[model samples]
Target: MSIRQLFRMGMVTVALLGALPAAATTQLRVDLSQLSRDSDAVIHGVVRRVESRWSGDGRRIVTDVEVEVKEPLKGQPGGTVLVTQPGGQVGDIGQVVHGLASFKTGEEVVIFLRKRGTQAFRLSGQAQGKYQVVREEAGKPAMAVPEPSEALLLDPVTRQPSTVVEKPRTLAELKAAIRAALTEPAP
Candidate 1:
């Protein structure tokens, strides 16, 4: 091939590579201690409402979740709080942001929040900070499980890639861990 033709082919290859979707989002793995220490507030709550709409700039869709606080583990977030996260379905259009927490109405959860504005909050460590509360059966104790994510997580201290297969903990155990973490010095 001529030099000019080779250059044009190279340009096309570069353009195509850039157009491909990202394989996975990457972030540091946040453990329970980090979640407790970094969060402005941590609360166990039930999702009262979930609404998705276009952002003020009209560039993206965001979901606002209203959580009724059942227990405040860290800060005084009051009876209810609004937590917003990027991506959601709005009308017939939708956006999905990988490694972000998703909330559903009436679902029970323990959320680690960071204050954004006067009254709004966001997840402390994105997907790592949200744990769903589940019960196997009626009268059984509930379990708290970290929300699953497709993101690649790196170790915070080592900065090396890490894989975490979290095991579900009882609600009591999770609460205890959070409380214990609260007492330890921040890293």
Candidate 2:
């Protein structure tokens, strides 16, 4: 009931709220091979091409996509890599699945990608740019936004991202949890 007590309580609330993202940081520890399936994820890359094709059911649909590597996708061309996925969506739900629309050739955009199997990556929507495509070095693809370097709850971890979630209160403890989340194997 005292003013000092209320102020302390408010500060604690704010601090906890800020930690929510980190504390809730969940990573899917799937086998990198899982990247080869129809699984979905957010992909960042440039749009290289588009195709209007038919699905196995022979339904008329557009499969628009191109190659997009992860930011600094490691010793690879940083341009559109031909790809495709379903389109049309509205929100966080879209992030949860495939993109909401098809991409266009030469459009610099970030996509939420899913692997169609152990073969290649698929598009989830006609994604938008998550980074500013600026070439960091000559003779190299443009630079994209640096990934957050965190974890996704859907990442299929074999173990939990954090083991100390008994609720860490210190920065050091939180960081340890994050490291564990990153290194721990996913189921």
Candidate 3:
């Protein structure tokens, strides 16, 4: 092949590699109990807005999600709360932090939140800390659905794959569980 042709092919390969989506380097495997223990606040709310922007340091992209609190299972986050998570698109550039929880406007969710400094809160265990609320049937109340990625997890101690079977529960039941967890002594 001509040198010019080889140079063009190399350029195309480099561009294609840059366009590929980022893959998760680490998988989070936290059960409900662990999520509760790690979180400072557990809240059931609807996402009111989502805003993406570059971090103050300009090192990474972050998304700020405003959640209108319907109930506070732990802590005292009244009214609206801002939850920040890593990963977002800014203009032509985009960054995807795999395993990070994402939120959409008007979406209902149950979130286990850990305080970041004094102002922001983040998911305790990435996707494992966020639960989508979905209706079971027409005219039925909504239930919290755990992340599908949690279906299979690697046990930290054993370093072996283990299936995590999550049972659907109503919002009230989930709140109760969080309350119970709050009363228990931390391990």
The TM-scores of all predictions, comma-separated, are 0.86, 0.35, 0.79
Off by over 4 Å in 2: 1-44, 68-82, 87-99, 123-187
Cα shift from native, residue 62, model 3 (Å): 0.8
* lDDT digits (tens) for residues 3-29 of candidate 2: 999999999999998876452234443
lDDT of each: 0.92, 0.42, 0.82
- What is candidate 2's TM-score against the reference? 0.35
The residue-level lDDT of candidate 1 at 44 comes to 99
Ranking by lDDT: 1, 3, 2
Candidate 1 vs candidate 2: the TM-score winner is: 1
Error of 3 at 163 (Å): 1.8
- Residue clash pairs of candidate 1: none
The TM-score ranking, best first, is 1, 3, 2
Compared with the true structure, the alpha-carbon lDDT of candidate 1 equals 0.92
Instruction: Return the TM-score for candidate 1, rounded to 2 decimals.
Output: 0.86
